[model samples]
Target: MEIISKLSILIVILFISCHSGRGNVDVQQSADSIAVCHIGAIPSRFTALHKDTLSYEKGEDNVRMVFIRGGKFKMGSTDFVDAQPVHAVEVNSFYMDEHEVTNAQFEAFVKATDYVTVAERPLDPKEFPGVDPAMLVPGSAVFTNPSKVDGMDNFLQWWQYVPGANWRYPEGPNSSIRGKEDHPVTQLAYEDAEAYAKWAGKRLPTEAEWEYAAKAGNHTSETYYWGSEKKENGKWLANIFQGDFPMKNTKEDGFETTSPVKSFPANAYGLYDMEGNVWEWCSDFYRPDYYMQSPKSNPKGPSSSHDPQEPGLVKRVQRGGSFLCNDEYCERYKAGSRGKGEVNSPTNNVGFRCVKDI
Candidate 1:
């Protein structure tokens, strides 16, 4: 496989958290202050939903959503080549999930549809013509830490393709999500996320929509969802790596892997895990230079995917950072940073939430 292809596979596996500091407050206390609106119980019109608080929920699983009253904002950043050429863009108002889709919520969808995720299917030999059929077993990528590594370039050093690894078995066949139903669902490919969205009567957010909501109507150029600072008054606002990447995790955020949804305080618009939890799949195709040709109002992403590093493979945009993100290496936890993965590749670290048109 090409380097980019390898990187995409590794991205899925590396998906992998924090704590009290100055101005420390209990998480439960913070949640109690925010009002949660339930879907179906609230007005069906977008304007009505927008008038209420920015958060909503529905179904037995309580799929929470937050309304984003969108407008013009600068998209992209100059810090990275792909995020370069920052430009102004506008998006209409919409409702977004308050947190990443939880395992319980996805389970409800699967039970209703009897759906099987892409990760559960065996690989097709035609896709890898020269590969031995023996290696084509069904599986998804899972993260494993080596004692040490030379550098981040060799992703295979930390990522392993384990048979029987899927959403329910995030680590592999031996692992299970028995008590982690509230945690974000993982090992999901792009199609898997889209399938759940369709079943829930929602859709994945566009890159522009995701970015706009992440900004939370701030409109000002900022590095994080909360503000320019990564932490607030010494408190770790989001779940992200606190120690060495792919080796040691300090667990300062009270979680070493995926935490339950709403473990941290929500953003200004009441969206949780917008910075770090799992990288979310966007509706648009990936393109490094899409910002240059992006529209001023409600820009969807590029018409088709294109990654110069691996042009042959189709990819989609993955926003937000994940639990594995760290400042030393994968600084993607930053709000404006961007990531991409192959459409069919699934990993323990990759998951998604949904959005409604209203």
Candidate 2:
């Protein structure tokens, strides 16, 4: 996977996946990072927290759930270095959102509770001690799809930090979610997802539970959540990259970006877009070697996050691949693979669904 080497200067964002050989480059040498956003930084979006206890029924009214009769399944995969040492793990049955949290859902939560997303909040001077205040404007990572690239190592070729890019404006100041109400909400940090989950009386699913529900009944097998083939009877199963990576998108899957929820068929467990569309944030703190020492049943990842690539920044596990996953560059679209991102660095390709305990 293409990893974001550093966010110290321009991007101020999180990294992407830990997929394959990037052939290592000096983190400091290449510093002409993504350009800053055009607009001025947003004013105080902070709102007072509500003290009244929220009633579960108030939020549960809109949630459509699928009962995951979770059982023992191989928690990790040998395909990638991170999801390695494939081992047996178990999880109790629980309820999960039928689809990813939609823009409509998040918009409702924001309006009802006056919640402001992390991407909307201005950056702190303490985070970047010497960095220019102008570049510290609030924004999130957005894929630009560069014209031509040398190799896959430098992910900066595609991802850019766009100011004024929040859930309301997915791409930049000009973008909007007018008619895409049912599409999965993107440009959200882990806490943004967590906040929506909390308001909905739900929690982000553990990586184990996510994989279990994603695998459906195909546990212990190396098959996709839908099936072994990428297509069935010449029809694409999920929304993923179709053509050239970072340059040309064939859009063979009928969507160049996020497709509306249920645009594709549901998995056997009645889950929609479990593999692609947008990467879903899990409740687990990411550790590449977590599975090596994970317990047999109900493993909840490492206690604290640690990415050898960027040790100082804390990251969380992001499951499922996005529309950008292609064979040439990012093939993490395969089953049993993993992706991660910094806790506060929201990106356009990552969003989340929620789960509730039985």
Candidate 3:
């Protein structure tokens, strides 16, 4: 419900839902959420995707997927509740996209299949009993800077549903991705990512695989992707929020919102933006307690999903962090930290990459 004004959804679809079908949408206060968001469908022109993401060179469409040799490492973090128990997890070697999927690459898939994303569709009025049908237009949650702040408890201060705010028109229908084709596609639901994965001959990585990949085959267990400090040589190492949350961004990483896929350096596995940029989707269904019983070898997460907050909907795991993450608010940019969202929800900051069996 998080984007459409569900009263129950913060548009988690911003994925900030208002209140409607799945009721009592609580303020999502976490490292994963920038303000509050929801998934929405906002259609764009066909020619939009064909723009040159290759400005990054190597044709972002052909950007090489990295080969990650797998092994065991501590899978969860000590601080977060869901990531606790620090279990040992081993995964098989796999091929992972060196970076998140870009707008240009997604355009190719859309062009090839004429596929439509969830946010591009209209809302089913059956889901909302008392709301005006006219309000249920295609849209997604977007982070708007609040003019003033009484407190951070209410995400509605910055997150809202913007009609026609799909991946192409990230901010809304009037916005354009013309020069930002190289940025990871946003406003995508898990199903959208899955559809794209199927078309691309790949699949989303399992949570174990994703964590292992982020760890880059156990390069370090320090929890920090690049060790203790957030900066390397006095320069920011990854793309994360460096100022006040939902209000101000210092743009310390040379980016205010989403940046080009390879704008930051890669990990030990030759993977770029694994720690920050945008939250990448993982294949596993999310269960906060899954780690307690997770298998030691190639764990595939829980059989079903559960989130006490949004108990009515199923949620999938999202990893890495967005530009909204910072020590002041979201610290999910830390390695092994986890994010979860309603399965159908998409947001401006939430995007995904893919992986495959080797």
Candidate 4:
């Protein structure tokens, strides 16, 4: 099993804290709140939800989850509203897959249960209300060659909302997963991840638990999981876009697109790809001001929001940034960073990992 060591966890915390941009927001004071120091303060035990015990049985090359002892740690980012206040959060001990669920793992699930992802099916015309069929055309996010010609910041140029794009056809109509069994499954909706988790006797990690586990048992507030030192002690820790945004990947990390899980070193918690590889789905509704109203212990976000951005008020938090993220455009690859997308919107850059009660 892959374990993100306690040391790496500390590095992530410290690095992220330092990297968090300066904030003018008021720091909420807590009567009993203590500045994070002892790593043992975080909770590390959990009640198993599945009766079937999970063990590391060597298989084809999929990385398995490592049990992490949960404890208290600061959740949210110091800079972004999505990660505000850096409050204390405690998660029960849970088992998290070392890497994001890969194409191989998703394939096994499909073969075993004949599961079909939502993106693989067409959207009901009625679901769109008055939308045209052309607009309703089935599609998923695809990486574009930004330099081939034109605008780079916008993802639409390359991430065409293709009509037949799904996990099987990641690049769209003509593309298929034919030879990439080891790649992390993409274009997975939140429900898709939930389905796979159910089949595996696991569930998606809550935002707090996910962040805490990503931190491992580290006590410092360093940026990035590896520490304050850039380039992973003079080496890159995970796969991220290099060169200019959208175009010119340069494969600096040796990957133009997604890399296999654990292609980088695990954080202190022994969790792999916690910072990059793919954007993971978290089980929480995304509210920009959530952290401000969040509880200091085991926050679960708001029951509802008054924000007009979401008409139906439907959105979920995505963590660990994806291969598509770059310093030029998307910086969500950091541990404390975050992004949001519709629960039903599946993209080639979006994927997920699972968690289970210890």
* Prediction RMSDs, each to the true structure: 12.4, 6.3, 7.2, 12.3
lDDT of 4 at 27: 31
Which window of ten consecutive residues has the lowest lDDT sum in model 4? 36-45
lDDT of each: 0.70, 0.74, 0.72, 0.63
Winning model by TM-score: 2
Error of 1 at 87 (Å): 1.2
The lDDT ranking, best first, is: 2, 3, 1, 4
Q: Which stretches of candidate 4 lie above 4 Å from their native place?
A: 1-63, 128-136, 148-154, 305-313
For all predicted structures, in order, the TM-scores are 0.81, 0.86, 0.85, 0.78
Q: 84 in model 3: Cα distance from truth in Å?
A: 0.9
Q: How far is 29's C-alpha from truth in model 4 (Å)?
A: 24
**Residues 123-236 of candidate 1: C-alpha lDDT, one tens digit per residue:** 555654565666556676676767998865565666666778889999997999989989999988787787777667788999889988888877666667678876777888
Candidate 4 lDDT score at position 64: 73
Off by over 4 Å in 3: 1-61
Error of 1 at 97 (Å): 1.0
- Model 1, 73: alpha-carbon shift in Å? 1.1
Best by lDDT: 2
Query: Model 1 off-target regions past 4 Å?
Result: 1-62, 128-132
lDDT (10s digit) by residue, model 3, range 1-358:
3434453252332232311111122323223333232333222211223222212211124658898887878888765656777888788899999999999999987776667777777666666567677777777777778868888667667777778878889899888889998999998888788877776777899978888887865545675776778888888888887777667777878998899988877878899888878888888987767887898999988889776655656678888878777765667667777777666667888899988898
